[model samples]
Target: MPFYLEIIISVSLLTGGVFLLVGSYGLVRLPDIYMRLHSPTKASTLGITGVLIASMFFQSHLKGFLSIQELLITLFLFITAPVAANMIAKTALHHSNKPAEKTQNQALMDTIRDRESPPSNSIK
Candidate 1:
Protein backbone atom coordinates (compact mmCIF):
# COMPACT_ATOMS: atom_id res chain seq x y z
CA MET A 1 0.00 0.00 0.00
CA PRO A 2 1.08 3.57 -0.68
CA PHE A 3 1.97 6.01 2.12
CA TYR A 4 -0.88 8.30 1.11
CA LEU A 5 -3.36 5.47 1.37
CA GLU A 6 -2.07 4.57 4.80
CA ILE A 7 -2.43 8.18 5.92
CA ILE A 8 -5.99 8.35 4.63
CA ILE A 9 -6.96 5.14 6.35
CA SER A 10 -5.31 6.23 9.58
CA VAL A 11 -7.11 9.57 9.61
CA SER A 12 -10.45 7.98 8.85
CA LEU A 13 -10.04 5.35 11.55
CA LEU A 14 -8.99 7.96 14.09
CA THR A 15 -11.99 10.12 13.30
CA GLY A 16 -14.28 7.15 13.63
CA GLY A 17 -12.72 6.21 16.94
CA VAL A 18 -13.12 9.72 18.29
CA PHE A 19 -16.80 9.87 17.35
CA LEU A 20 -17.41 6.44 18.82
CA LEU A 21 -15.75 7.48 22.05
CA VAL A 22 -17.80 10.66 22.22
CA GLY A 23 -21.01 8.75 21.62
CA SER A 24 -20.17 6.24 24.30
CA TYR A 25 -19.30 8.95 26.77
CA GLY A 26 -22.47 10.84 26.02
CA LEU A 27 -24.58 7.72 26.45
CA VAL A 28 -23.07 7.15 29.85
CA ARG A 29 -23.02 10.74 31.09
CA LEU A 30 -26.23 12.24 29.72
CA PRO A 31 -29.05 12.68 32.20
CA ASP A 32 -32.04 11.23 30.34
CA ILE A 33 -33.14 8.79 27.68
CA TYR A 34 -33.95 11.49 25.13
CA MET A 35 -30.56 13.11 25.44
CA ARG A 36 -28.84 9.75 25.57
CA LEU A 37 -30.59 8.68 22.38
CA HIS A 38 -29.14 11.69 20.57
CA SER A 39 -25.60 10.57 21.23
CA PRO A 40 -25.54 7.05 19.80
CA THR A 41 -28.00 7.72 17.00
CA LYS A 42 -26.11 10.70 15.60
CA ALA A 43 -22.50 10.41 16.71
CA SER A 44 -22.23 6.65 16.59
CA THR A 45 -23.91 6.63 13.21
CA LEU A 46 -21.26 8.99 11.89
CA GLY A 47 -18.57 7.05 13.66
CA ILE A 48 -19.55 3.76 12.05
CA THR A 49 -19.96 5.52 8.72
CA GLY A 50 -16.41 6.77 8.99
CA VAL A 51 -15.13 3.31 9.75
CA LEU A 52 -17.09 1.91 6.80
CA ILE A 53 -15.62 4.57 4.52
CA ALA A 54 -12.16 3.59 5.67
CA SER A 55 -12.96 -0.02 4.98
CA MET A 56 -14.22 0.84 1.53
CA PHE A 57 -11.06 2.77 0.76
CA PHE A 58 -8.81 0.00 1.96
CA GLN A 59 -10.74 -2.72 0.16
CA SER A 60 -10.91 -0.73 -3.05
CA HIS A 61 -7.20 -0.12 -2.98
CA LEU A 62 -6.45 -3.76 -2.37
CA LYS A 63 -8.85 -5.27 -4.90
CA GLY A 64 -8.95 -2.45 -7.48
CA PHE A 65 -12.75 -2.16 -7.20
CA LEU A 66 -15.26 -0.54 -4.91
CA SER A 67 -16.71 -2.68 -2.17
CA ILE A 68 -20.45 -3.00 -2.45
CA GLN A 69 -20.78 -4.45 1.03
CA GLU A 70 -19.45 -1.34 2.67
CA LEU A 71 -21.72 0.80 0.55
CA LEU A 72 -24.72 -1.28 1.57
CA ILE A 73 -23.74 -1.11 5.20
CA THR A 74 -23.43 2.66 5.00
CA LEU A 75 -26.75 2.95 3.23
CA PHE A 76 -28.48 0.84 5.83
CA LEU A 77 -26.87 2.79 8.62
CA PHE A 78 -28.09 6.04 7.12
CA ILE A 79 -31.55 4.61 6.72
CA THR A 80 -31.96 2.96 10.10
CA ALA A 81 -30.28 5.20 12.65
CA PRO A 82 -32.75 8.06 12.53
CA VAL A 83 -35.71 5.75 12.08
CA ALA A 84 -34.65 3.81 15.13
CA ALA A 85 -34.15 6.99 17.08
CA ASN A 86 -37.55 8.27 16.08
CA MET A 87 -39.15 5.04 17.15
CA ILE A 88 -37.38 5.19 20.48
CA ALA A 89 -38.48 8.78 20.95
CA LYS A 90 -42.04 7.82 20.18
CA THR A 91 -41.89 4.99 22.66
CA ALA A 92 -40.57 7.29 25.32
CA LEU A 93 -43.35 9.71 24.57
CA HIS A 94 -45.92 6.92 24.69
CA HIS A 95 -44.70 6.09 28.16
CA SER A 96 -44.64 9.75 29.13
CA ASN A 97 -40.96 9.60 29.79
CA LYS A 98 -39.71 12.76 31.42
CA PRO A 99 -36.84 14.79 30.07
CA ALA A 100 -34.15 16.24 32.26
CA GLU A 101 -34.74 19.66 33.87
CA LYS A 102 -32.54 21.44 31.35
CA THR A 103 -34.06 19.79 28.28
CA GLN A 104 -35.93 22.23 26.08
CA ASN A 105 -39.20 21.86 24.21
CA GLN A 106 -40.78 19.62 26.79
CA ALA A 107 -44.27 20.60 25.70
CA LEU A 108 -43.50 19.77 22.11
CA MET A 109 -43.12 16.14 23.00
CA ASP A 110 -46.48 16.14 24.69
CA THR A 111 -48.01 17.87 21.70
CA ILE A 112 -46.58 15.25 19.40
CA ARG A 113 -47.83 12.45 21.56
CA ASP A 114 -51.29 13.94 21.58
CA ARG A 115 -51.24 14.38 17.85
CA GLU A 116 -50.18 10.81 17.26
CA SER A 117 -52.84 9.33 19.47
CA PRO A 118 -56.23 8.70 17.92
CA PRO A 119 -59.17 10.61 19.41
CA SER A 120 -61.22 8.72 21.97
CA ASN A 121 -64.32 8.91 19.79
CA SER A 122 -62.47 7.04 17.05
CA ILE A 123 -62.14 4.04 19.33
CA LYS A 124 -65.90 3.45 19.41
Candidate 2:
Protein backbone atom coordinates (compact mmCIF):
# COMPACT_ATOMS: atom_id res chain seq x y z
CA MET A 1 0.00 0.00 0.00
CA PRO A 2 2.99 2.28 0.19
CA PHE A 3 3.69 4.80 -2.59
CA TYR A 4 7.02 3.20 -3.46
CA LEU A 5 5.46 -0.25 -3.76
CA GLU A 6 2.85 1.12 -6.14
CA ILE A 7 5.56 2.67 -8.29
CA ILE A 8 7.48 -0.60 -8.39
CA ILE A 9 4.39 -2.54 -9.39
CA SER A 10 3.47 0.04 -12.02
CA VAL A 11 6.93 0.00 -13.53
CA SER A 12 7.01 -3.78 -13.67
CA LEU A 13 3.58 -3.93 -15.27
CA LEU A 14 4.61 -1.34 -17.86
CA THR A 15 7.79 -3.19 -18.73
CA GLY A 16 5.93 -6.46 -19.10
CA GLY A 17 3.27 -4.83 -21.20
CA VAL A 18 5.87 -3.29 -23.48
CA PHE A 19 7.68 -6.55 -24.03
CA LEU A 20 4.43 -8.37 -24.67
CA LEU A 21 3.45 -5.77 -27.23
CA VAL A 22 6.79 -6.00 -28.96
CA GLY A 23 6.59 -9.77 -29.09
CA SER A 24 3.09 -9.72 -30.54
CA TYR A 25 4.13 -7.15 -33.10
CA GLY A 26 7.11 -9.20 -34.07
CA LEU A 27 4.98 -12.30 -34.45
CA VAL A 28 2.66 -10.49 -36.80
CA ARG A 29 5.28 -8.58 -38.76
CA LEU A 30 8.15 -11.04 -39.14
CA PRO A 31 8.48 -12.54 -42.60
CA ASP A 32 8.78 -16.22 -41.66
CA ILE A 33 7.83 -18.74 -39.04
CA TYR A 34 11.44 -19.32 -38.06
CA MET A 35 11.92 -15.61 -37.47
CA ARG A 36 8.58 -15.30 -35.74
CA LEU A 37 9.50 -18.02 -33.28
CA HIS A 38 12.13 -15.80 -31.68
CA SER A 39 9.63 -13.19 -30.53
CA PRO A 40 7.14 -15.22 -28.53
CA THR A 41 9.82 -17.44 -27.08
CA LYS A 42 12.29 -14.76 -26.07
CA ALA A 43 10.47 -11.47 -25.73
CA SER A 44 7.23 -12.90 -24.42
CA THR A 45 9.11 -15.04 -21.96
CA LEU A 46 10.72 -11.96 -20.49
CA GLY A 47 7.40 -10.18 -20.64
CA ILE A 48 5.61 -12.78 -18.61
CA THR A 49 8.52 -13.02 -16.26
CA GLY A 50 8.26 -9.31 -15.58
CA VAL A 51 4.57 -9.58 -14.86
CA LEU A 52 5.07 -12.57 -12.63
CA ILE A 53 7.82 -10.79 -10.71
CA ALA A 54 5.48 -7.88 -10.19
CA SER A 55 2.81 -10.23 -8.99
CA MET A 56 5.22 -11.88 -6.58
CA PHE A 57 6.24 -8.54 -5.18
CA PHE A 58 2.69 -7.28 -4.80
CA GLN A 59 1.47 -10.51 -3.26
CA SER A 60 4.34 -10.64 -0.85
CA HIS A 61 3.80 -7.07 0.18
CA LEU A 62 0.10 -7.60 0.72
CA LYS A 63 0.23 -10.98 2.44
CA GLY A 64 3.60 -10.75 4.20
CA PHE A 65 4.70 -13.96 2.51
CA LEU A 66 6.09 -14.86 -0.89
CA SER A 67 3.77 -16.73 -3.19
CA ILE A 68 5.36 -20.01 -4.24
CA GLN A 69 2.88 -20.67 -7.03
CA GLU A 70 3.96 -17.63 -9.05
CA LEU A 71 7.56 -18.55 -8.51
CA LEU A 72 6.94 -22.08 -9.72
CA ILE A 73 5.05 -20.83 -12.73
CA THR A 74 7.87 -18.47 -13.62
CA LEU A 75 10.41 -21.25 -13.26
CA PHE A 76 8.32 -23.63 -15.37
CA LEU A 77 7.76 -20.99 -18.04
CA PHE A 78 11.45 -20.18 -18.27
CA ILE A 79 12.27 -23.86 -18.71
CA THR A 80 9.55 -24.69 -21.25
CA ALA A 81 9.35 -21.69 -23.58
CA PRO A 82 12.68 -22.30 -25.30
CA VAL A 83 12.05 -26.04 -25.49
CA ALA A 84 8.65 -25.47 -27.06
CA ALA A 85 10.17 -23.04 -29.53
CA ASN A 86 12.78 -25.61 -30.47
CA MET A 87 10.17 -28.28 -31.10
CA ILE A 88 8.06 -25.93 -33.19
CA ALA A 89 11.08 -24.88 -35.23
CA LYS A 90 12.04 -28.48 -35.84
CA THR A 91 8.54 -29.25 -36.97
CA ALA A 92 8.63 -26.33 -39.36
CA LEU A 93 11.91 -27.56 -40.76
CA HIS A 94 10.54 -31.09 -41.11
CA HIS A 95 7.71 -29.66 -43.16
CA SER A 96 10.22 -27.77 -45.32
CA ASN A 97 9.05 -24.30 -44.43
CA LYS A 98 11.02 -21.83 -46.48
CA PRO A 99 12.56 -18.66 -45.11
CA ALA A 100 12.07 -15.22 -46.56
CA GLU A 101 14.07 -14.22 -49.66
CA LYS A 102 16.30 -11.97 -47.59
CA THR A 103 16.93 -14.50 -44.85
CA GLN A 104 20.59 -15.08 -44.12
CA ASN A 105 22.53 -18.33 -43.92
CA GLN A 106 20.58 -19.97 -46.71
CA ALA A 107 23.38 -22.43 -47.41
CA LEU A 108 23.55 -23.47 -43.80
CA MET A 109 19.89 -24.26 -43.78
CA ASP A 110 20.22 -26.22 -46.99
CA THR A 111 23.23 -28.08 -45.69
CA ILE A 112 21.36 -29.09 -42.57
CA ARG A 113 18.39 -30.19 -44.57
CA ASP A 114 20.45 -32.10 -47.10
CA ARG A 115 23.01 -33.79 -44.89
CA GLU A 116 24.23 -37.18 -46.12
CA SER A 117 22.52 -40.27 -44.83
CA PRO A 118 24.41 -42.51 -42.46
CA PRO A 119 25.85 -45.78 -43.71
CA SER A 120 23.44 -48.73 -43.81
CA ASN A 121 25.93 -50.72 -41.71
CA SER A 122 25.70 -48.31 -38.84
CA ILE A 123 23.76 -49.18 -35.68
CA LYS A 124 19.99 -49.01 -35.97
Candidate 3:
Protein backbone atom coordinates (compact mmCIF):
# COMPACT_ATOMS: atom_id res chain seq x y z
CA MET A 1 0.00 0.00 0.00
CA PRO A 2 1.09 3.56 -0.68
CA PHE A 3 2.31 5.67 2.24
CA TYR A 4 -0.39 8.31 1.70
CA LEU A 5 -3.12 5.69 1.64
CA GLU A 6 -1.81 4.19 4.85
CA ILE A 7 -1.85 7.61 6.48
CA ILE A 8 -5.42 8.21 5.35
CA ILE A 9 -6.57 4.86 6.64
CA SER A 10 -4.78 5.37 9.92
CA VAL A 11 -6.34 8.77 10.38
CA SER A 12 -9.75 7.49 9.52
CA LEU A 13 -9.43 4.58 11.93
CA LEU A 14 -8.19 6.87 14.67
CA THR A 15 -11.01 9.33 14.17
CA GLY A 16 -13.55 6.52 14.01
CA GLY A 17 -12.24 5.02 17.20
CA VAL A 18 -12.42 8.39 18.93
CA PHE A 19 -15.97 8.91 17.78
CA LEU A 20 -17.01 5.47 18.97
CA LEU A 21 -15.49 6.12 22.36
CA VAL A 22 -17.19 9.46 22.68
CA GLY A 23 -20.47 8.05 21.57
CA SER A 24 -20.31 5.29 24.15
CA TYR A 25 -19.35 7.75 26.84
CA GLY A 26 -22.25 9.94 25.94
CA LEU A 27 -24.56 6.97 26.10
CA VAL A 28 -23.43 6.37 29.65
CA ARG A 29 -23.18 9.99 30.81
CA LEU A 30 -25.84 11.94 28.99
CA PRO A 31 -28.89 13.05 30.90
CA ASP A 32 -32.51 12.52 29.94
CA ILE A 33 -33.97 10.55 27.03
CA TYR A 34 -33.81 13.25 24.36
CA MET A 35 -30.33 14.45 25.24
CA ARG A 36 -29.03 10.88 25.23
CA LEU A 37 -30.37 10.51 21.71
CA HIS A 38 -27.76 13.00 20.50
CA SER A 39 -24.86 10.77 21.50
CA PRO A 40 -25.77 7.46 19.94
CA THR A 41 -27.72 8.81 16.98
CA LYS A 42 -25.17 11.39 15.92
CA ALA A 43 -21.76 10.32 17.15
CA SER A 44 -22.17 6.62 16.46
CA THR A 45 -23.38 7.49 12.99
CA LEU A 46 -20.32 9.52 12.07
CA GLY A 47 -18.06 7.09 13.85
CA ILE A 48 -19.33 4.01 12.08
CA THR A 49 -19.38 5.86 8.83
CA GLY A 50 -15.72 6.61 9.22
CA VAL A 51 -15.03 2.96 9.94
CA LEU A 52 -16.98 1.95 6.87
CA ILE A 53 -15.05 4.41 4.72
CA ALA A 54 -11.81 3.12 6.14
CA SER A 55 -12.80 -0.45 5.48
CA MET A 56 -13.87 0.31 1.94
CA PHE A 57 -10.65 2.17 1.20
CA PHE A 58 -8.46 -0.50 2.75
CA GLN A 59 -10.34 -3.31 1.02
CA SER A 60 -10.25 -1.61 -2.34
CA HIS A 61 -6.50 -1.01 -2.05
CA LEU A 62 -5.87 -4.64 -1.16
CA LYS A 63 -8.27 -6.23 -3.66
CA GLY A 64 -7.90 -3.92 -6.68
CA PHE A 65 -11.70 -3.77 -6.91
CA LEU A 66 -14.25 -1.85 -4.90
CA SER A 67 -15.60 -3.79 -1.96
CA ILE A 68 -19.20 -2.72 -1.42
CA GLN A 69 -20.19 -4.86 1.54
CA GLU A 70 -19.11 -2.22 3.99
CA LEU A 71 -20.70 0.49 1.87
CA LEU A 72 -24.03 -1.34 1.81
CA ILE A 73 -23.86 -1.98 5.53
CA THR A 74 -23.09 1.68 6.12
CA LEU A 75 -26.05 2.69 4.00
CA PHE A 76 -28.29 0.35 5.93
CA LEU A 77 -27.00 1.67 9.22
CA PHE A 78 -27.57 5.27 8.18
CA ILE A 79 -31.07 4.57 6.99
CA THR A 80 -31.98 2.53 10.06
CA ALA A 81 -30.37 4.49 12.88
CA PRO A 82 -32.93 7.26 12.74
CA VAL A 83 -35.76 4.76 12.70
CA ALA A 84 -34.34 2.85 15.65
CA ALA A 85 -33.71 6.08 17.47
CA ASN A 86 -37.21 7.24 16.69
CA MET A 87 -38.64 4.04 18.02
CA ILE A 88 -36.62 4.37 21.17
CA ALA A 89 -37.66 7.97 21.66
CA LYS A 90 -41.24 7.11 20.96
CA THR A 91 -41.15 4.31 23.47
CA ALA A 92 -39.55 6.54 26.05
CA LEU A 93 -42.11 9.23 25.45
CA HIS A 94 -44.89 6.75 25.79
CA HIS A 95 -43.56 5.38 29.05
CA SER A 96 -42.14 8.54 30.62
CA ASN A 97 -43.89 10.50 33.33
CA LYS A 98 -43.22 13.82 31.65
CA PRO A 99 -46.33 15.91 31.64
CA ALA A 100 -48.41 15.59 28.53
CA GLU A 101 -49.81 19.06 29.11
CA LYS A 102 -46.47 20.81 28.69
CA THR A 103 -46.26 19.83 25.05
CA GLN A 104 -49.25 21.98 23.87
CA ASN A 105 -49.88 19.20 21.40
CA GLN A 106 -52.87 18.43 23.56
CA ALA A 107 -54.28 21.82 22.68
CA LEU A 108 -54.87 20.65 19.15
CA MET A 109 -56.67 17.60 20.41
CA ASP A 110 -58.63 19.76 22.83
CA THR A 111 -59.81 21.94 20.02
CA ILE A 112 -60.79 18.97 17.97
CA ARG A 113 -62.67 17.43 20.85
CA ASP A 114 -64.47 20.72 21.53
CA ARG A 115 -65.49 20.96 17.91
CA GLU A 116 -66.87 17.49 18.00
CA SER A 117 -68.74 17.98 21.25
CA PRO A 118 -71.64 20.20 22.27
CA PRO A 119 -70.33 23.07 24.40
CA SER A 120 -71.45 22.90 27.99
CA ASN A 121 -70.94 26.63 28.69
CA SER A 122 -72.31 27.92 25.38
CA ILE A 123 -75.11 29.85 27.10
CA LYS A 124 -77.77 27.45 25.90
User: TM-score of each candidate?
Assistant: 0.88, 0.89, 0.76
lDDT of 1 by residue, 1-124 (tens): 9999999999999999999999999999999999999898989988998899899999999899887799899899999999999899889988999899999989888788788556889886
Candidate 3's C-alpha runs over 4 A off are: 97-124
lDDT of 2 by residue, 78-110 (tens): 899999999998788768899998888877877
Please report the candidate that would top TM-score against the real structure.
Answer: 2
- How far is 42's C-alpha from truth in model 3 (Å)? 0.5
Q: In model 2, which runs have C-alpha deviations exceeding 4 angstroms?
A: 116-124
| Residue pairs clashing, model 2 | none
Poorly placed runs, candidate 1 (over 4 Å): 116-124
**Candidate 2: C-alpha lDDT:** 0.90
Q: For model 3, what is the error of residue 70's alpha carbon versus the real structure, in angstroms, after optimal superposition? A: 1.2
Best by lDDT: 1
Worst ten in a row by lDDT for model 2: 106-115
